[model samples]
Target: MGLVLGDAWLWAAVEWSPPAVAEFYIGGGFDTPTVVALLVAALVKAALLWLILRAPAPGPLDRRAKALRRLLYLAVAYALVLRYPIALLPDAVDAAFQLALWTAIDVLYLLVIRWRSRMLRAAAGAVFAVELAAMADVLLDELDLPELGSGYIVELALMLGGVAATLITLVGQRRDGRWSRGTQTAGWLSVGVYALVFPLDVFGRMSGGDMTVPVMMDALGYVGTVWIAATARELPAEGRPADLPPARRRVIRVAVTAVAVLPIIALIHPEATPHLTYTGWSMDCYDRPSFGDLKPAERDAAFLCRARSTEGGVPPMFPDSLSDQEILAYGRALCRAKDRDEQRALLTRAGSASARSADQWDLVYVCPEIVGAAHPELLWSTTEAEAANAAYIAEKNAKCRDPWPRTKGVVQATANYFLFVDGDPGYLVHDPEDEAADEAAEQAMGKVYDDSTRVGVTDSAVLIGHVADVADVCLTVKAFRTPPPQRTAGWDQVNEVPIVSRSGQLTVPEMGEGGEVGAGAPMPNLAIAGKGRYRLRVYVRVDDAEEEQHLVVVFPGASRKRLKLKPRPVAGRALSFNSPSSGGRRAVARGAGGRSQAELWS
Candidate 1:
């Protein structure tokens, strides 16, 4: 009972270890809450069992009971090693540690077996010896092992140990005339557990339906350990002589059969046998707001279906009902419907016929009309969605269509730089109260031609400068492997700026419609390598827009505007310098000696 209670406590710690234990217990150096809890509980059980052992009770300790109690302590130790800690070990050492640990526990188990007669004890010992021999490679230090190979050997040894023990018990029972189906021993029952649990564990873990595999496995193992101890405890002194009642014997056989069948049924239909299970968490689809309650088989089918349906998108999972299938098929059907009335008809028919929930949620975008009052958020009118979508695209087109017009060298332009593609002095006329969205759009645009020459360039057009009043301004670009020495002393202004590229291409786009945001189309294609620093030299004779020859010297360096050549104003940024009132040209502020404030000439 102490052993079982101890297991219960440890199992609680295991179940709660993740969030609960991790949330609270962060003191010990080990940092493993489950391990600490398990070890502590196991130790407590050991102490309690030891106290029980030492307590002088009656004549002699019932030898079989004493053996079983000692075995319970061994089982407690086994339980300690049974979970979480072993998994935390490095796989290289995990195998070796597992072998050593289990070997020690098995050795302890061997020392604890107290059979009725000398021959029984000797037979058990001999069977154990053979089992140990079969697993000799585990203790043998020279055996080279793969990663987890030793662990596999340990598992095989355990299974083989069970097989050997069961066989020996059966042979001995047969020889001693103790063989009786009605009162089959624990060893006979253990074979079923060993056989069934391995497959169940494998399938359950791989089932994908089971979210609580680790917790459930630990729990089932704990139960199995308790059952083993219980069976061990039932061994009688003087072996329950031939005077044992037939009714009691028959009851044992029935109990054994029932016990063996119950667990298998529980694994297959855990929802039906919820009492038998440890963890209640699973994809049972029972209480979820799907449609209605699922029968046990339907629930099981849906759970496994969802689990195994690991395809591209969420696969259609439903109980075996054509009505459910029809509801699932409605997603595609509504999309093909001619109009809202037709869609409503299709949805109503399906909804009336089946109680299954819509399988694909994202399909709401396709079939929005089906999103009735139940899901009010999705109850958006088609016109509203289209309007919103059109608004979204128009906004994208307005903001992302072209790069901001910017000027390079000093002397601000009187005309030519169109601040917006739509020729709006402010911005998209559609956005009145939503200037914040426009501002967000501009910030996302990533390039700004502010009052400062030392500017943060974006992947917008590499450079947009203002060369005023050009009949046909000749713009030629020269790329440099290394920066050529600057000769802009005589030049009007030299603006050294950094060129930024995200698409890996930079270019001087002709004054036209650039494509959408990041995918800006350059002159037909693109070039000037990648993002790097550039130095632009502007030469002007003060009135040179007629045949302005602008030579942009591109190089990899840093950005530093020619300071003091143009002093920047604190405020009064023009919405568009290319004002419609200015005969489709930009107006600039002129300062001392008729010199313009700020501009990008190219």
Candidate 2:
């Protein structure tokens, strides 16, 4: 009784069962059917064991009987302790430790079993010792010994030993004259089943294969336990009655068979259906408003017909009055009628134009007849407003398209020019008075610009500049209309500007101490022949660093006015004049010194 209780508790704690179906019997939290079943089964078995324990003793307790009773108590205690606390250890350690403890308990139980001969006990002991060694290897991660090669050899040896033990035990049981033929045959059969199942189970686990074999072994083990408990008791002396009555024995056998079959049934049962809330198309057609007037059977038939047809299959049963094609057509028409009626009902409840929702507008757009009768002007006005808004956006986008050529360094007449310098705090302009001031200004400028530059476009100009440290600089020039706000509204609002043309890499050498480098010529032949302000933006990059600057040139509608050459800092880089300009064209030079030298000539 103690052994049975302990085994039951151990199995429950570990949840030893088939992988795919184990959840149906042992998983799910409290309140689930499977968990409830397990609790009921456990309580019933516990109650039965309690009744058995309460029964009168058969005879005086011998040393072997006392030892067996103590061992049972010990097994129960060990199981309870491990199940609660010790099982919390790391998986490998917990499994290995549990196996070792169980192995010890099994050896003790075997010693108390009162085997017919010493030879049989010895064989069993040898098999258990081999099993214990294999378990130890598992505990140590297959011994981690190079010569062992994954511990398969040790497992195979243990399997062979188990085979030998099973054969010897069967032969010994057959030869014994103390027990009845029925008992010996049952013992041999149980041993044979175990011998076959155990190896297959071991191999399945080692190879990580399918669990069907292990599940079978578990079922067989349950039956074997019942058989061992029923037949392994000592026989009464000559002319004595059996320990249990014939009727009781038959009842026990029937009960044990039922108990063993329950788990197998649970293991093989189909998985529970997942609970899902029905929504949208999955909602039953019978629940729709259209089905309110129909009879229950008619409603069911309609839903079934629609469901089957929706799945692209013929309905099993159709209306007696309708053909197959007519049934399908009728089902589809009913569904569409219900949808249209429901949509109209919703629009009606939403009231006239003042209270209409987005869904009502959508319905009106698709089926104008539904709401257009009451709110014709509202629908017409909405349609015109949407068309106008779309047209406005399209016109703005058309005006913002790329307005420059694709070629590098090929400046067009309408193209604006920009310049920028790349460094940390960006472009620095210093006006040093003396050599000492120049050195001081150079240090200050170095601290300011460090390793960065500035680049971008303004109202009507493109200013492209580069710092001296930069080895290679690429400038991409893009044009945007500056006046007539509606024409450039889209480009003005967006963060990403459109690229019109690229200047490739304007490769420049490292600046010599006394020499000046021309950044680039002014964008020549600009065709700014419109009333609007035109701007050119230059995207400058020194190596991998980015800088942006812009230059704006306004065309006052063909008026020839002498525009002053005001050196303004555009996008943080100072525009400086190196020499005097007599003609209208401004000749700009980027110098190494800290200051710009400008001479104005008329």
Name the best candidate (by TM-score). 1
| Leading candidate by lDDT | 1
Model 2, residue 232: what's the lDDT?
34
lDDT of each: 0.39, 0.36
Please give, for residues 1-602, the per-residue lDDT of candidate 1 as tens digits: 32254434444444534434433322332224445545565554454344223322223345545654565555555555544665675554554554554455455444444345777767777666656554544434335543222455565665487577656655544444422332235456556556556656756654544323434344434434443443343344344324348887787678678757866764564433222221112433333222123343353334333322333344332222233334335556755566667655764564333233333233443344454323433334435444543444344234321111242322111211223222221111011123243343244233334543312233232333332332122333444546655555433434554443334443442333221111111221122445444443322211222223344545445655442333332233322223133321111110001111111111
Alpha carbon RMSD to native, model 1 = 18.1
Query: Cα deviation of 61 in candidate 2 (Å)?
Result: 5.6
**lDDT value for model 1:** 0.39
| Whole-model alpha-carbon lDDT for candidate 2 | 0.36
